[model samples]
Target: MSTFRTASRVDGNQSTIVASLRRIGCTVLLTHQLKNCFDILVGYRGRTHLMEIKDPAQPPSKRKLTPGEEEFRRTWQGSPYHVVETIDQAISIVTAP
Candidate 1:
C-alpha cells in the first residue's frame, strides 16, 4: 500500500478544517488520491458529503478545477458536493440541518 501524506499546498487552513471536523464528531476522510476525486469525504449523522478544497486567497477567476475534478463532479450523483475555502464553510455544509 502507498503511504499517504498531505499535499504540499495543503497548509494550515486545510489542516484546521480537518481537525475541527473531527472534533465536531464528523468522520473526515482525506481523499487526495491518484484518481480523479474530491478532496475530502465527510460522514455525519448518516449523511455523506464530498468536498473540494480550495485556497481562500486564490482569486475565483484563477481557481480553475482540474479536468478530472470536473468530470467527477459532473458524473457524481451522490450526496451534495461543495467547494469550501474555509473551515467555517466546511462546517456549515457538513452540519446543515
Candidate 2:
C-alpha cells in the first residue's frame, strides 16, 4: 500500500470524505486492522454494503488480502463488495434505495 500512499496522497481526502459522509447522515466505519478500511462497511437503507476505495492516480493493481479480511468478506455473503475509485461511487452505494 506504500505505492498507493505515494501515488495518491489521499490521507487528507479520505478524511474529508469520511466527514462529508458523516455530515450527510451516512454511517461510516473506520477500522485500523484492515488496510484501506475506512468507508469499507456501509449499510444502505435496506441493502448490505461493502466497498473498498482507491485513488484514480494509483492505477489498478491487485494485492492479496490478509486471512482475516478475506474471511470477513466471505462471511458477509449477501452484499456484493465493490472497489470504488471515488467518494461519489460510495455515496451512490449508500443512497441507492
Candidate 3:
C-alpha cells in the first residue's frame, strides 16, 4: 500500500482563490497543513501576502477563526495577514497597487 498522506480539508473557496491568483500571475502555495497558521502564501510583483480562506457560504459568525488560527494570528509577528472569503477579494489583494 502507498504511504502518502492527504492534507487537511480546506475552505470551499480556497481552490478557486488559488487558481484565480495563479491565473493573475501570482505564485500560490498551500500552507494549510501548518499548525495554527495561515492557509495560503501568495507572491506577486516582489511582494508576499498571507491569506486565511473563509467560506462565504457560511454565516459571518460561522466563519470565525478556529482557536488555533486565532492563536496564530494573535502571535504572528510578521506583516499583516488577510482573511478572504471570495475570489474577488483574493484577486484584489495580489493585484492591488
Candidate 4:
C-alpha cells in the first residue's frame, strides 16, 4: 500500500484520456488523488498499468513530474510507471502486450 500525505492534482487532459481507455474496454481508476503517485490505474488483458497523465497543452516544465513522483516511480516495485502526454499514448500502453 502507498502512503499519501497530500492530495494529488489532476492534469487537464486526464478525463479525456481516461474516457478513451474505457471506450477501448480498459478499466480505469482515478488514482490521481494519491500524492506522489501515478494518475491512473489501468486494467486490461488481466494486467494492470500505472500511468502518469501529462496534459499535452501544458508547457514542458509543468508537465514534468515532481521530485516526490520521480522518487516514487523509481522505487516502486509493482507495475512500471508510464508518462503519457496524449490519449493515444495512454491507449497504446494499456493495449500493448
Q: Per model, how many backbone clashes are there?
A: 0, 0, 0, 0
Model 2, position 31: C-alpha lDDT score: 45
> Which candidate number would show the highest lDDT if scored against the true structure?
4
| lDDT tens readout by residue for model 3, 14-82 | 889899899889998899877778899999999999999999898988689889789888888885689
lDDT of 1 by residue, 1-97 (tens): 4344344344236778889999999999988654667788999999999988887677776456678778889988888778888889999998889
Regions more than 4 Å wrong, model 4: 1-7
User: lDDT of all the models against the reference?
Assistant: 0.79, 0.57, 0.86, 0.88
TM-score of model number 3:
0.85
Candidate 4 lDDT score at position 1: 61
* Candidates 2 and 3 compared by lDDT, better number: 3
Tens-digit per-residue lDDT, 1-97, candidate 4: 6676565667899989999999999999988877688889999989999999898889989988999789989999998799998988988888777
- Top TM-score hit: 4
Instruction: Report the error of model 1 at residue 57, Å.
Output: 1.7
Backbone-clash count (model 2): 0
Candidate 2 least-lDDT 10 residues: 3-12
| Model 1 regions more than 4 Å off | 1-12
Error of 3 at 70 (Å): 1.1
Stretches of candidate 2 off by over 4 Å are: 1-12, 35-39, 62-76
